[model samples]
Target: MRMMVAGLAMMPADAQDIEPDGPDIVVTAGKPLRVDAKLLRAAQRRFAEDRPAHAPRATLRFELWRGYSRISATDVGLALTDGAGGQLPVTIDGDGRVVFATLPAGRWFLTAPAQSQGMHLRPIVLSSGTSVEDRRLGDLRAQCRVMVAMAKADASLLAMPLIGMFDAIGGCASKRFGFYHPVEHPLASATATGAGVMRTLRLSVTSTSYEAPLSDRNLPNDARVRLAYR
Candidate 1:
């Protein structure tokens, strides 16, 4: 099967990246805050209605940095290792965010691939009604970029719209670029250039499999890309 990869390149020139809007505040350890039972029950009902069934949810936000500039870190691979030695792979969304909707309450160690920098790798404890947001992952040089593929038949119809969608949500400029794949003969990869300051990037794709290589790492042999149909 011939698949056409659509590269979404976000240059630093066109759009400015966004930063956290407010000051960073630390939550200090203190006496347990009390909540009224009526309010707690109402809130629980609302949360259950909005979230997946029977799973505790949490949010993690990542910020990428290159020296003094903040860049978008999208398409980066994240994994949560639980106490039982099981690992759950999660993808950072276009907004440099990941939501854990089905993770059970426990201790988890969050980590990125070896090629990633500026991420938190420490153990985090999660419980019901708790979430971690706007946590600084650390500073990382620009390494990973975004790439996607579609059936060659749908390339023309889907290309521009996909690019625009990425730009609108990721807050980066989208363009086409070239990349070479070893076994695939020719692979398309997008490279962003010209130093446009961007704060976040969002890349979305409907595919059975996708892989983002760590910086300075070769593409893996088992990378698979299959179109996902609804």
Candidate 2:
């Protein structure tokens, strides 16, 4: 996938200058994208030419939607525990996410500091499926105008507030952390969304992962989305 028409504003680096420093693969189902920023623009052009035409759908869009922001967490830490009264090993990613490499099929508890100190809920009985996959952009507020977006069919663009906070003029899903990441780290969301590349972290999760459905809602309209998965 390539970057879409979100107004790419980087000083063009000739294609010959790109050195193969990492993997540059198509972001397909169950596959992850890992590419270097230096090679991004050239990749976008390459993919856009070969990309297929969509059936006049809404523009592809990805944004750091203010509607999905979480509440301001106070040193909000998370932990995992096994049912055997034992603690499980866990780690925090750069994005402040609790990651467990492999979870066995057994009852486990995720501990966190919520509203009340004595607050404790039953171990969640879940069916292993998440509809909306949102990975919060960490510390990107200063870079708001620099957001970049790409389309699955090789469309890519940039979101610059210099264009009037044009792409990013709203809020976060939660008000916790201020979202920056418009296009600095290449925050990308195009007028359309397909398997386009954005930042480094290719999505192995979320809406696009399921492929475009018969009735699609991921339209594009220049929303200022923070860079995620980078």
Q: Give lDDT tens digits, candidate 1, residues 124-178.
A: 2122342222111110001111122111212356566654554365321123221
* Span of ten consecutive residues with least summed lDDT in model 2: 122-131
Q: For each predicted model, how many residue pairs clash, with residues at least 3 apart or on different chains?
A: 11, 47
Ten contiguous residues minimizing lDDT sum, candidate 1: 135-144
List lDDT for all candidates, in order. 0.28, 0.25
lDDT for 195 in candidate 1 is 26
Tens-digit lDDT string for candidate 2 (22-95)? 11122233322222222223323322332223211211112111112322222445455555776654455443
Estimate TM-scores for all models: 0.24, 0.25
Deviation (Å) of 162 in candidate 2: 46
